[model samples]
Target: MPFPLYLLAMAVFAMGTSEFMLAGLLPDIASGLDITVGTAGMLTPAFAIGMIVGAPLVAALARNWPSRSSLLGFILVFSAAHAVGAMTTSFPVLFATRVVAALANAGFLAVALTTAATLVSPDKKGRALAVLLSGTTVATIAGVPGGSVLGTLLGWRATFWAVAALCLPAALGILKGIPAGRVKEEATGGPALRTELAQLTRPRLLLVMLLGALVNAATFGSFTFLAPVVTDTAGLGELWISVALVLFGAGSFVGVTVAGRLSDQRPALVLAVGGPLLLIGWPALAILADKPVALLCLVFVQGALSFALGSTLITRVLYEAAEAPTMAGSYATAALNVGAAVGPLIAATTLSTTVGDLGPLWASGLLVAVALLIALPLRAVIAAGRSTEVLP
Candidate 1:
């Protein structure tokens, strides 16, 4: 509830809008560049790949910088990239800008998490993170659709310009609000940075990240094509697609808030409940696709449970990597992006096959079940560790 927290959320909202608004702008971009829609679609993966590769590297490179400086620098670069993108007429130029923008996004997100965690008491970390992540959910509900409509009315380039303009205020917020110093690292003495990076290979940590990735894939697999699925299978008009999106976003907002409060005390329980909910929701969605009301209800439930699991997953990862918060945040960002990249690919393949639009629901369900299987063992792992030492 601090002013700086709002600034952090604003930066995330800008980054998230840039990240997701592309989904709506793809056809326009394709037409503008005289490229195929499939080619334009490649920009999404390019951005994801940039995030996956950039976050850890940026965290390592900026390890010694003040958090405020790092945040401001990253967001400035993000704005610059979007400005360049707004002027480019070539597909390659636009694609390259997306990569650059995503790299900046990764850096900003990593620094923001580290900054948020540092600003608040250990007991409040989950709540702070939830506040930051709400930006993304809001962007999904408002920014994406708004960008699409703006592009339709003005131009796709105008949307990029608008995003670029938005970033200036975010950067200014970071400068004015965030403390101008490095975050104090937790004192859990390790060998060195080399040894710390090696902690990434730990079985427990890797398992948590894997769970994060799988959860994302399960959610995004069906979510990527929600517009078409709602209309074609749910038997709804185009108007209802936007309504469904807002409902899902509202549910996500609620889920993150609740998960944040419970995560510090009952993270495992939250994950346990969320994973099964997704597994059940997706399959039920597949069966009830023709029932408009049922489909709407399931979509909201699925979104809520997905974010509940996601926020808890993030809390656990931060706890697991308490010694190296920046890189831990980076790893979390990369893991989510990996799932974001893979989920749509799998969903698209399903949409092309005989199974039709309903295939994504089943695919997402199977992925969630696999994630649950992997996560089930984590409870025992946490219990054994807790028996030895208390976790934050």
Candidate 2:
């Protein structure tokens, strides 16, 4: 791996840790702020909303900036937000910090994708993107769990401090590793925001973005409820939640790695084989809800299948929206975050019915079914995209 790529991955790990670690810290934060956990929960959605809305907006505004400066600026803001959040006693202040951090994170992800793509050969772009994305999966496996432990051992505030502390090395690395210069687009004053928006309007681009969103909805939908599923449905202890988290994270890390290796060569074919497997996996998860060992194993399978689909779709988004590299990443970032925001609401609706703990799994299955239906027609487009051949 290039040294610069390592720096990008480290930065992503810090950003990913900051975003996902909030779930574990919510209880402590709520108590400290003298608010209900439910209210504290709003911080997560606020961050999601920031990602959804800020990705395109920030990507466009920073389109003319040097990638190095843009990346470094994003890191500075993210670090400051966490630092402020750590010291704040007010819930609203903390909430604001979450949104600020998310906006910075959203920009970093969008820009990082384009940056990573440029750092490698055309054939190797998929692998490079995967390298950047792997940081997030590793975060799931290590960072989130570590943050939870850190919070438990120290206090939630210390986790915030640790996240901020991670930024120093990453910032230093960025300054040293990434070449300092403006891109061709920046020298040419970049396309108008309208041009970037036009790229998003292309049907092929929209299709890929939607596919990314739907897959994530399925992923986060089921994932959001894993703890309840473990304890309530599977009749396991709280320890099982940690086990499930690790299994799912590990499987996703492996899956993304597999997708990266095959993406440039056989994206559509992977979708064909993996999509049905994913569709089938969900119902099994629901049916085996009461069987602890079975359910836990299936959780790993679900994670692999879903992330394989997700990572492939994201790579496709890059090809489909090749006209606007940075904005393409923004569209991908916004699409995934949109799914993350919407999935739980869909699953939450099912809880009022007889489904109970099965709701999330069944809801995820439905989302996957829809994604397949959408994906079925787009395999040709995905294949066409490889050669810059857009089907009519």
Candidate 3:
């Protein structure tokens, strides 16, 4: 990969860390602000909601700005938000900081991926996207663990401070490493926006967005409550739960890498495989939760299969929506955040009155099965579209 790709990846790593670290730090943050852990948990959902709102808003506003400038500005905003969040004594203030930080994060990711795709040839788009997105997977493997450890030892605020420190170096790296002309310029003004919005109205693109949302809902619904389920139903110790999360992170690392490679070869097949795997894994996870050894294995498998869909789906959407790639990419990010927001809500509601923790898993499984059925007809639409040829 190019040096600019590495710089983009670094920014993504910090953003990923910032987004997920809240979960690990919730207890410390709650105690510090004299709020309930449930209230602290609201931070995660708040961030996702902000991302859903920010992706399109930022994309539309920054459409004419230089990509390099836009990226640097968003990083500055993100860094400042984290710094403020770390210093704040009030829960509400901290929550607002998180929301602002999430806005920056969502905009950065959408811009970064769109920028990455433009930097490479069409055939190599998947690889470029993979290189950029690997930072998020790496964050799962390294950033979350390190942040959690830091939070445990030095308090959650310290973790945010450390994360804030990273932003400066990441910004500097981007400034120095990425060339001015790295991002391709689109035709600007009213015509560009109109063209992009029209592409979004296409049935094929809309279906892909819906499929992306459904797939995410399926995976995240169960994943959002994984720790509690492990403790309550699996009868595992907290330490074991942490170990399982690490295992899941390991699987994500491998999965993202494999997905990157396979997407370049067969994007559609990757999606086809992912939907069924999600459907199977959820129910299987419910069954295996009682067996500690089996549960660990399932965690790895579930992580791998669940995340494997990402790169493939992204590349396919970009390909199919070539007329307005940036807008499509932004919409895709919005869809992802929408799923993130909805998934946990569904899981929490189902688990509220259930007999066991398995309720979430079963609910997630059924949701994925429905998504899979919906995707079948859409897959045919994509195939049929590809089969047609236009006359010169």
Candidate 4:
């Protein structure tokens, strides 16, 4: 764990905060821009679209550049975008800024993950990714809620200014901490774009991407509707929403910590533990929605299980496609966002068409079950391969 890793974590925290803070400030933004909340809510997915589009594009463009320089440039652009966003009043300008910020975020994360991975040994990649993703869970815990309060007290624009301020220290640290010429110029062009794309089509890489997506779909699908389920179904009222969310965040933090420690030696085993937790947690969540305490407890467990997949997914992809590390990581990021997109759509559709308030829970549980079915066989293969080597 070099100091640069922690600095990268700080950089990730700043970007992660901007990514999620919009969710909490959508109401204020809607009123300020004179748009409906639903229209304002579209900013979240717009950002995701930018992320999906940006990662590979940035990797191609910056293929020759050093990771430290690329990281600094992206965060600088990200900070400036937020600064302009703080001054903008029109909805279109704000939305454009969101997309711009998201593009910067995507590029930064793709580089950061690969850079962090390369800095450590093969076995330590799990911990490296966990260090980086911990920032995201921390944002869920602190940044989103804090930004919401800031927007309520000051204005939505104030939150943007605050986010801009957060980026400054990270940019400075990247400049000072990450040594120049640290990352090797990537293996001097062995493959063309067509070949690289063809390589990425391998079944193992695809499975890893699908695993990333499914795990996230399960986590976020159910979470998107948690407020309604807690308040309406459990009769817990609005205040409990905040408490439940905090508990969820706390559980997420714990999960990442524990998973980081174990995933290096037992990556597949971590997934084995995590997948079943969702299987048990979700049905319990649906059944116990009538009991506030039980619902809250299950939410915590589900949150932990959901996020515990983060390191395992990334580590698995890294090993599966070691030859194309940057693209592999970018693909994983895109895949996880794909799941993020899918989860919400499934939950929203289930609520509108079929299931009622409990729809998301049931839908998410089924998704986790499918992901587990995928994981079980994959885990068996991984274990078999390892056993063959060990016995030989």
Candidate 5:
């Protein structure tokens, strides 16, 4: 692709790093701020809440702005929030900054999704989005771990500083790459803000977004408690936690890469094969939780299948919301964030029951089966779209 897409991915790497790296930095942050780790942990939900709200709210507010300006403004705000967060001694201040940074991240992602899809030809949208999302997968594999290691060696503030510094080049890229004066709405012939917002209520779009969210629910549910599943359920040591995470991330990268290439060409086939595998993979994972080798290996499979389904749903969201290009990205972003925020909360509830650590896996299975049931009536619709491509 385009050179600008790479820059967008770079910016997303910084955003994704800040989003996830907190998982590692929470203990250090709590210690430094003289707060409990539980207090520090609240930052994760704060960020998620911001993303859930900001993705739609900010995109709607800036719906009429030029793409380059909106994008640059978001990056600048994100960078500033990190810088302020790095210098603040107060936990509340840090918490506030995390929310601000997440808002900027959410806005940037919304605009960037449209920008990425707009930059390429119609058929290549999947590849473009794949390239953009790769940053997050790469962040999971490299940035999150590296941030943790960096914080351990230095301080939590250093990780914030590093993320701030990382955004400088991305800001520069935004300026250099996204051409000036391309009003986002005008480019796509997007309607008024009210009309754009109305797209969120469309039945087809709503169902697609719901399916995407459920897929992500399964993904985040499984991923959030992976450490417990590996260490407690599978009878592994702490060291195996990192190994399992890395394997999962590696599989996600492979999954997204493959889906990017194949989704538009054969979405029907992707849904046909990938969906059932995903549906069954969870129960198998839960059943084999006690078997170390089997459980660890299944983590990789789950990652691949889960992401492939999630990514396709995003592509479909854009298609279904074709009339509302500006908010289509918001719909997609908000859908995923909805899953991100709700999935873990739902999964956490299972821990209190007799199910214990195995609860998340079973919870994931129930969510996946429901998503596929929703998919059942929609298969004909999916197949009909690709006649010239796959359906024909």
Candidate 6:
């Protein structure tokens, strides 16, 4: 609805591209850097670790800065870190660069969420947040595939270079579009932070965070090792694996778009429906892996249903902690990153010690079940919130 929101979306697109392109380019990066694929995979975790640590820390540090300036500075830092990553030949140096880049990227997202909330009226907050977050889905559909194709045609380093270049324009867009002032009129008094922290003490809000973590664990735990499972375990060709990824990305785009629209109407219903579908899709996917067509269909369904829950879940967190919207949003993002970091490591261990690729599916199913159980208790809370006179 706002021009500044569009600029923020572009920033999100660039960040998502940089973050997710690694999965497709992992092999290329490993070969280029004379490292194993296993080692290359660590970069994903590194980025998540950065996000987990950076979101709250940076949000706190930038609490007093003008939102526009903070966002622009973070983008510059993001661009610079990627530039350094593209140029580095040493493994340690590249790792450090990734950490810095991811930290900036996480900080950028936290600021962007806060900025988006400020850009819209209270009643339209859900839709506004959904529109801003939809950029991540768009990146999955367009940016990641485009960057992966470029990496295949050119080099992995070239992909990072492109991401770095995109960030420059994003930074400039934010500078020109967003007003240069503190986004929130409410002062970030010490008591405000304390109140925000206290919001987490509520069972409803805490349940939302735990559900967020479980949902992420269910999807990402299996997704992190998708390529290996497809190629090595399922006997699919490399090209097929790429096609599956693209299919998954397509599903993600559709899911998020639909979820965004539905969130404006009935967020709780979307989550109640979508969460179980995600759990169901995983086992179905594992069962159909040997059949190319079936597996592809399952991949699409899995991707769609898995990500479809995002907006609803995040909205749930915000609703539960309405008194501290920005801090709640930041913590929500932090919880997601923490899950992202933990999921893959747990999956990796399961795969190594277990009999089949089914390990991830089973584990994911269990995680999803736990998340669903958590959501059940919150039904009354959400229903009560909806019945209230609150507009947003």
lDDT order, best first, reads 5, 2, 1, 4, 3, 6
Total clashes in model 2, counting residue pairs 3 or more apart in sequence or in different chains? 0
lDDT of 1 by residue, 1-392 (tens): 67898899998988988898886788898999999999999998999999989989888887667788889999999999999999998888888999999899998888788778777777677788898998888887788778878998999999999999989998898899998755535234323567669879787778778888888888778888888878998778987887888788778888888988877766667866777777899899899989999999988888899888887777666666676765778877877888888888888888878879988888888888888776675575542222124333
Candidate 2 C-alpha lDDT tens digits along 125-183: 67887788888888888888899999989999999999999988999999999999735
Misplaced by over 4 Å in model 2 are 182-184, 187-190, 385-392
Q: TM-score of the candidate numbered 4? A: 0.93
Q: Tens-digit lDDT track for model 3 on 1-392?
A: 67788899999899888877777888888899999998999999899999999987887777666789889999999999999989999988998998899889888877887788777766666677778877877887788888989999999989999889889999998888777665435554334777877887777777667766766776677776788777878888877766777777777767777877777556667767776787888899898788888888988887777677755666556666666756656777787777778877888788766545777788788877877788776665532222121011
How well does candidate 6 score on lDDT at residue 181? 57
lDDT of 6 by residue, 98-201 (tens): 89988898888887877787787655556667777777767877888889889999999999999999998888999999997556434644336666668878
Clashing pairs in 4: none
lDDT of 2 at 192: 65
Measured over all alpha carbons after superposition, the RMSD of each candidate to the real structure, in angstroms, is 2.4, 1.5, 2.5, 2.5, 2.2, 2.6
Clashing pairs in 5: 387-392
Worst 10 residues of 2 by lDDT: 382-391
Provide the TM-score for each candidate, comma-separated. 0.94, 0.96, 0.93, 0.93, 0.95, 0.92
Ranking the candidates on TM-score from highest down gives 2, 5, 1, 4, 3, 6
Query: Please, what is the whole-model Cα lDDT of each candidate in the order they appear?
Result: 0.82, 0.85, 0.77, 0.79, 0.86, 0.77
Q: Which of 3 and 6 is ahead in TM-score?
A: 3
- lDDT accuracy of residue 387 in candidate 2: 32
lDDT of 1: 0.82
Could you say which candidate leads in TM-score? 2
Sequence-dependent TM-score of model 5: 0.95
lDDT of 2 at 236: 93
Clash count (model 3, backbone only): 0
Judge candidate 2 at residue 209 and give its lDDT: 87
Q: Candidate 6 has what TM-score?
A: 0.92
Better of 1 and 3 by TM-score: 1
